[model samples]
Target chain A: MSDVIKLAHGDGGKFTNELIKNLFYRHFRNRKLEEGIDAATFSVNEGRMAFTTDSFVVKPIFFYGGDIGKLAVCGSINDLAVSGAKPLYLSASFIIEEGFPIDKLEAIVRSMGDTCTRAGVNIITGDTKVVEKGSVDGIFINTSGVGIIESNYKMKTIESGDQIIVTGTIGEHGTAIAIQRYDIKVKGNFKSDCNPLNGITENIQDLYPYIKIMKDPTRGGLVTILNELAELAGLGVRLIEEKIPVSREVKAMNEMLGLDPLYMACEGRMVLVVNKLYAEKVLNRIRSLEGCKDANIIGNFDQEASLKVYIENYLGGKRILNTLEGAMLPRIC
Target chain B: MSDVIKLAHGDGGKFTNELIKNLFYRHFRNRKLEEGIDAATFSVNEGRMAFTTDSFVVKPIFFYGGDIGKLAVCGSINDLAVSGAKPLYLSASFIIEEGFPIDKLEAIVRSMGDTCTRAGVNIITGDTKVVEKGSVDGIFINTSGVGIIESNYKMKTIESGDQIIVTGTIGEHGTAIAIQRYDIKVKGNFKSDCNPLNGITENIQDLYPYIKIMKDPTRGGLVTILNELAELAGLGVRLIEEKIPVSREVKAMNEMLGLDPLYMACEGRMVLVVNKLYAEKVLNRIRSLEGCKDANIIGNFDQEASLKVYIENYLGGKRILNTLEGAMLPRIC
Candidate 1:
């Protein structure tokens, strides 16, 4: 009966039932969720859909721009969104360390509910399990979401000559978390660019119609994503070093620490491959959207049938962008 | 580079990418998962679908009947099955402890792959994250599944006069786990009842057409689930104590350990509410199926608008079956 969660709350007995009714159900009240069973049954819109799952083990649980809850919701939502899906339903499962504060858990759950509202999705059903204190760090959340891809926007490829656009200033999320994790004191008004990207994508529906491929540069960041795409499409990408957006503070930290921002994680930004005809139009439309004022057509598919990624330098020299190979950072998402 | 898993394997950089391409791809190769991105895009079979998620942290990872990997797949698949869905695509995420053996991880993933194969589902996409050595136990898996429902069997309630039938002997999953966790020696052929219930349900569909509600007796077990139905339907259930099936070994262990089988988990069994007119027919159909040879009609909804569960004894006495209120067993799933 203490306010803190006990091992019994996850034992699938009465305590678990009460915890669910008092905490999760209190925040995620909805018709499908009201059934309150193992799996939530609901109607799905007919057509193509995207499904994604991500586990958030971001240390400290609470971060500068968002907590693990917000990160979980937005992360999965962004995955579905960039796939041209209208993120709809989500299921959240939590692995909490025993002795975790109930107040903090409630706050995280409330944040998740709020994020779902902002992203136009519902948390239908979920699971919670508690482990011995040392068995887990505070808490880890794994969220899986299902979304209906808008038929008209179920876009396709990264053909040669297509322009590649970086949705906004890169590496803000990676920088914000890095600063906090390392306790580096060099400061500016730095916050994670951790917000839902679906709304912004919806705003540019006219341009979305022209885009070929869309993806959120999350864990491995922009460099890894570009390499993966180029390899998959058997094409080479040519990005201008000066054209990609980076916040002044992040750029300063990158230079000072000898870090590459291209490999840093970004929780909210996206990478798009659109045809040259709509390149400027897409960039202009994204610039008008909030959180995307720094949108730029940073690169292009420079070659066909060549699995390579190259960066054009400020001095007009070219360097190959190799796929990131090892851990520069962990749990940035 | 050693045989043990390193942190870099989950760093979302090069090592992580290679792990996915080599290990997971070799086991769960499927068309839907070939995209290998943040989200897997796929076409949906129209109509209503069931969405469910579960995180498995059953301690001692491997047990008599199945490991956490198998439990993860079957658990989520069963949730969707009980909701009348033909489980389809699954998304898996892992929180691995640093220094865990790569062979063990591979075994777990292989178990997941095999379970999905048995359940007729595909592992379309997944994620991996490695936390520092004590931040997590050896491993924890979270699986989310999307499945299509045979609309005809999509059911509603536990009405008065509905027959309650248990698919098979209960308490095996809980007992198997308890014996392992406590290192008890109860010499007998023991294994967790961890088979996929979807195929069993599908086999009985012709007779299951009369069922009103179906649910897996997982966390709360038979007693808790029966109480939940009574409370939800605002009805009282009456059961013949001797009719409820219990395996001889588990029953003996129950009496020897002062444990109640009614509150024990059964990973592979289901609790069903069916019209009295079809109870015997459905029982016959289920009895003819694998894992349900011991199926029996153990109870019935006896009263409307009265939230109570009562059992009739062999000696003509009666007792109340209260909802499980405390931790009898934890993590049996």
Candidate 2:
């Protein structure tokens, strides 16, 4: 009824009900959600399922490629996707500052609805709360999702010749956020790669037998995930520096900012470890998918070396890559 | 390693891993959680399941009876409990402000762990993010939970003469929050009724055949829920003013503050609609449980009256009760 949110909107009374019906219900309409009062009920077959959650507090709410609402949906979806499950349902919770514009809230909810529709996931249950102004910057969202695991998919142990493949060029999301956060002006077009990766996961569902592990290179980026995998598997990762794909725009921007693209974040990229025999096939399959033309087998695991990760230059020089040691960028995801 | 949270702790790298291992993993440890990398995966039988989520931003994070952490767990658990489901697993996500003391965070996490253990639910997966100081108040948590629906439970339609019952005294939680928030100095003891209601749900679970519906009188309180049920069921609620149970402390606090206990909140109470034939039995069962000694049959549905909710005084004077329309409390949870 008001132009902006009020304390009464979060009082769990008349205004809260009005907001849910006029805004959330209008956008996130689904059978399960319509019947839900306290909780959404649905039937699931007997199987293994994945559950995960993430809270989005990205500054500036709106960004080059997507807003916090889209990020919230994609972030949780990606988490379930990487865990070898097909995401099914999501629960969205919001904490908004009093006086936040109603139009902006509607826009964010619209984006979330659109994203979930594209990913074929339903937001089954949700909650909203309005804190006093200044208690929160503007708004924060938390999305928790559940997904059914593919019956054929199983995590395999890493072997001596396992190869690591990155689904796309790295660091687009981190660069986009940094540019906006630091008030840096950019010349050419640049945006975050903030799309859902469930499409890639679905396409590669048949290759689960060859996949040892899969992870989204999100907040910690490419190098960090490689370091984690190397340590987890107790093997060394030998990467070909030139083989890792990097977009020209992201590379130029990171160079100007004195940052490493390898350590920067990517919102919609996957790091997959596959047996050497099927690594090339997986890379080719990924490259055939949309937005994955740069997918490449950038490295391989070494059996003789200790747990470490390093990239070798074409000229024969090498540098060790550690788990991200500093706060290069905050809330990039 | 720092005394307070830093940007690096949320960077999803080494420090983040250390925080997860030393704190979250230590407190919320379980087989499913330990194996979780990006998401927690588990097996479930074929059946209907309930899913829900809530974000807790209750101010003064530490409260009279319980902390925000405990409230968050119980809030989500109660939602599922009232939905006729047995809660199974939960996901806890935190958005903390930078510079907040680590010890304070550990205390909150410990409270959450203890609450979940008592409720017989496991926190299988979680995520943590730290925002810059001043961006968020201090800390906010979102918990999403899933539960298995009991096969025999069915929501019977509310009919004429259906009885209304409340499982505890009303308004204790809202009164406690008001006192702490307004810095009221009172002589007698006062504490929030913030316990989980799963025990009560389990105790009366065998009477599913005669139960019409169940709802937690949380933020909007008893009067608001009655109004909603009357409108939804196309019947009138005839409440006997003297029959509604109220604690002496809450009654005195509301009277002093010029607030009506009927419209105040309760964190650990359930309002049940049951067939007249079984209402007395259900009330007796509820009264036998822990913390439910105040259970009472407060009213009954009127078939001849129009859809409305009203209270009848001892002199037979009637007053219409409406859904809560004003902002009486914020973040009462």
Among these predictions, the greatest TM-score belongs to: 2
lDDT of 1 by residue, A135-253 (tens): 88989999999988774775576678899998899988887888888888875888888888898777777666688888888877899899988877788888999999998888999
Model 1 lDDT tens row, B1-333 = 458778888887678877887788888889778777668987776688889999998987999999999999999999988988888889999999889998888898899899888878999978899987888888999999988887478567677899999999999998888889889977997789987999887787776569888989988689888888888888999889999999899998878778888888889999999999999988888888887888999989977427888889899898888876666766676
Docking class of 2: high
DockQ scores of the candidates: 0.73, 0.85
Docking class of 1: medium
TM-score of 2: 0.98
lDDT of 2 at A220: 76
TM-score of each: 0.96, 0.98
Error of 1 at A110 (Å): 1.4
Off by over 4 Å in 1: A154-157, A304-307, A317-319, B304-306
Name the 10 consecutive residues with the lowest summed lDDT in model 1 chain A.
A149-158
Which ranges in model 2 have alpha carbons more than 4 Å from their true place? Answer: none
Query: Could you give the fnat of all candidates in order?
Result: 0.80, 0.90
